[model samples]
Target: MKRTQNEKILQIQNHTLVVGIDVGKDSHYARAFDNRGIELAKLLRFSNTAQGYEALDEWMRMIMEQKAKTEAIVGFEPTGHYWFTLGDHLQGKGHRLGIVNPFHVKCTRELDDNSPTKNDRKDPKTIAMLVKDGRFRDVYIPADLYSELREAVSERERLQGQLIALSNQIHRWLDIRFPEFITVFKDWGGKTAQATLKNFPTPARVMAAGAAGVLQVWQKHLQRSSLKKAERLVRAAEKSIGRTAGSEAAEAALANLLAQYDMIAGQRQRIEQLMQELLLRVPNAGKLLEIRGIGMVTAAVIISEIGDIRRFQDPRQILKMAGLSLKENSSGKHRGKTTINKRGRRRLREGLFQVMIPMLAINAEFRAMHQKNLTRLVNPLNKMQSVIALCGKLVRVIYAILTKGCLYDAEKMTNDMKRSMKAA
Candidate 1:
């Protein structure tokens, strides 16, 4: 549940103890403070292990008993994945966990001592003070299927990055050794192209093998041989201006790159398969996939990033989480330009933007909306603005479908837009 700042501040009563922890890769430092920002105990140092967590819990209980505090709220900067274990530990122990923005901690560090220097001891106090002032957000830890979905999506992204890096390296290798290779086969990853590269990568090798040799290599993998393609490759090799030195080293490099590309490609395929399985486990995810432009991967990613749609009161919250919420800079009577805040999950925002492109092509309702945004009589948004607006619309649609258990209704969507236009 989302809480107002006042409500959050009220939660930190006199009997409540706020503990701020500075998370690290090896060791963590924590300090306890009363509701009024007074230190309750000395700084506690703990290792990043089970025993260390037990010691920290013991220390917190001691502080609570000594200071006459009834409840304890632990707050900390996320500090990457290091805090995940601690957050789960605290939550499991029945302590309320609050996540303070690392940026807030950095900005507010000078508030107490007015010193720019940083250390383990000074950060916990700043985190605790932020929690006291209600400058923290409730942490959302995915459980069950949501946890599996998140992990699967993360693995897919990692494999995607590896695939891209391997692709770039392969392209660079081809550019140096077989510059004209791309002209023959636009994508070297194709079966025939890959087989040819695996067998005869260099122009010298291509010349030695000739067209028949290349065709022999390709025929082993390809169902049908293209003599014209083979002849073209041979011609390009003959006129090639590729490097002649370091032939042995270049062969090894190309072999290694191709092997890495194949391995990463297989890994990505497996990850997508896993993502598909996990998406089935998520409730109402199939309804999202029913939309024309929303593929399995896109739906899985959106569901993974925004777990448990019931937590959000409205679609606007989802938009804000994606950093698609609009911001303005108006002051006094002067109207100012508005733009997206871009302060939330970057991957989510990118996924939304990418999904819009296919949506504009495949989804009639979305295409109509895009066209209306472009050709409207008054203050028509540009192409990019239209896409951004559509992204928000898509978020609302997904939220409604998931929360209300309704399927996509094209006519209803169009009618709603018409009513909105009339209201405007």
Candidate 2:
């Protein structure tokens, strides 16, 4: 939320105690500093537990009291998953938390003592200085519905990955056991195809069952399947050049893969359902769904990442947070090509691009804007560049919808496109 260096620097005033903590998985080392970056206390080592959190709170309080400070602003690098518990503990104790980038800590460690060597003591001082200089980002932990939504999205992704792996294994089984399986069924995941796979896994079994038996299996689960298709399947199986060895094990492997696929697919559906419910609970999230490209899950994910949109004062901040902000590597004479700086949330950036491609095809306003960007008379952008530009534009629109409670207007977007084109 503290977007400017001045604002961050201002947070560390005369009455503020800056505590730099070197967070670890088991034990953590902390060093306290005053507003002037002067050491306020001896290094304190504490275990990562409830009692340890209490001790940390007491240590900060004792330092604040001893130094005549009123507030404590704790700073630490987000070292993997170790800092989450500590951050939560600090926040609950009514202390402000600042997350310094690990890269910043690594770069700035050598400034003092001119030694690149890093230890617990050296890293704490480096972290504190970075916090004092306002070179840190705010640590945001989504709460309640937003937290639930984020967790659901994460779980869905995990399950989806498993599902993809299962699908690949199933295809691999088919490719080896029955190479001609795809000739009859282009996709083996369809209802009829799945039923056929369930009943007759190999070409030998398919040939044994014949067209009539295959049709019976398909019609058992599904309302109807083509007799002609069944006949084609039998014919393909008869001349199949698939592997004849290990037929039994291969069929069992297919069975296991199919079972795992069904389970993971079901889990993904449940997570999506939970995401939808949570999205509706989040304020102004339904409005996000009104946009053409953002579906229930995508809207939930965007809202989860942005979390309490009022924290951001501008749409550009959202773009930057999503790592869609443009950066260049130019020197005095050498003008370099500009591209997005992927220095922020990776999931948000990936989600935006993933959604944008489908949005270009489905969303009328975005589609038109993309075409205009490509065919513009001056400095026309290519396809990817246009998508990047559109992602930024979309951030502006999303920000407006969340902050101003405005509905997405296709006509207004079209007019804005025309004006932008004219200006270009």
Candidate 3:
């Protein structure tokens, strides 16, 4: 549930004990405080294990019992994956958890002692104070299908990064060994190109194999014959300016690169297949795929990043999460321009931005919106701004579709825009 600052502050009363934990890789430091920002107990040091979690829980219970508090709220910095296990443990143990931004912790460290010195002991008190003042955000841990989807998406991204690195390495290898290889095959990822690279990577190897040999190698993998393409490859190899000194090492290197590329490619394909299956478990995810430009991958990425759309009270929250919400810098006579915060999930923001190009080209409603944003009568947005605005609009559309279980409605969207413009 969403809460205002006052409401959040109200959650901490005299009977409530606030615990702040500075999470770490192995051991964590924690401090206990009451609603009045007074220290209630000595700092507790615990390890990142079941026993450590039990010790921390016991310490909190002891503090609460001693201070005559009935409820407890645990706040900590979401410091990478280190906090996940602790968060899950605390939530499983029925303690309410809140996440304090690491940036906020850094910025607010001077509030108490006015010193910039950072220690494990000093951080927990700051976190607890932020929770007391309602400056912390409630943490949302994805569970069940959402958890599976998040893992799948993360795995896909990791595989993609590996694939890119392998491709770059192969490109570097080709540049050094067979400079003309790319000229014959525009993309080395093609079946014929991959087959040729795997079987005969060097220009000398290709020349030795001859055109017919390369074509036979391709035929083993591909159904159709590319005789003309094979001829071009052989001709390019015959007059290639590639290095000839280290033929043996070059061949071995290319072979290893091809093997790694193939493995990563196969893994990516399998991960994508798994992601498609996982998408089916999400409620109303298919509605997103029903849109013209929104594919299964984009829908899966959005759903994975956003988790349950119901957790958001409105589309604005999703917009904020994507960091697409506008921020203004205006004061008195000196009014500055407004821009996006860019403080949210970067991958989610990138996905939204990337999906917009195809969406603008394919979806008439989105195309019209983009054009209007560019040429509207009052305060037209630039191309980039229009794209960002469309990204937010896409978030709203996805949120509404997921929450309401409705299909994309171009006419209704146009009508709503018209009503908004008229009201403006």
Off by over 4 Å in 1: 422-424
- For candidate 3, give the lDDT: 0.88
Score every model by TM-score: 0.96, 0.97, 0.96
How would you encode candidate 2's per-residue C-alpha lDDT over 1-424 as one tens digit per residue? 7789998898889999998999999999999998888998899999999999889888888888888999888999889889988988888888888999888998888898888898988899899999999998888888877778888888888888888888888888877888888988889889888888888998899889999998888887998788999999999999999998988888888888888888778888888988888888876768888888788877877888888888888888888888888899999999999999899988888888888988998999999989998998889999989999988888888888888888889999999888877776
Q: After superposing candidate 3 on the true structure, give the runs of residues whose Cα lies further than 4 Å from its correct spot.
A: 418-424
User: Which of the numbered candidates is closest to the native, going by highest TM-score?
Assistant: 2
Q: Please report, as a residue range, the 10-residue window in candidate 1 with the lowest summed lDDT.
A: 1-10
* Top model number, lDDT: 1
Whichever of 2 and 3 has more lDDT, that candidate is 3
Report how far residue 135 has shifted in candidate 1, in Å.
Answer: 0.9
lDDT of 3 by residue, 1-424 (tens): 5647887888889998999999999999999888999999899999999999899989988888888999899999888899999999989988899988889999999998999989999999999999999987788899799989989989999999998998899888888888898898899888878888888888878888888998888888899878898889999999988889978987888788788888888999999999999998798898788788988888888889999888888888888878888899999899898999998888889888888999999998889888988888899999999999888888989988899999988899889888867876
lDDT of each: 0.91, 0.87, 0.88
Q: After superposition, how far is residue 229 of candidate 2 from its true place, in Å?
A: 1.3
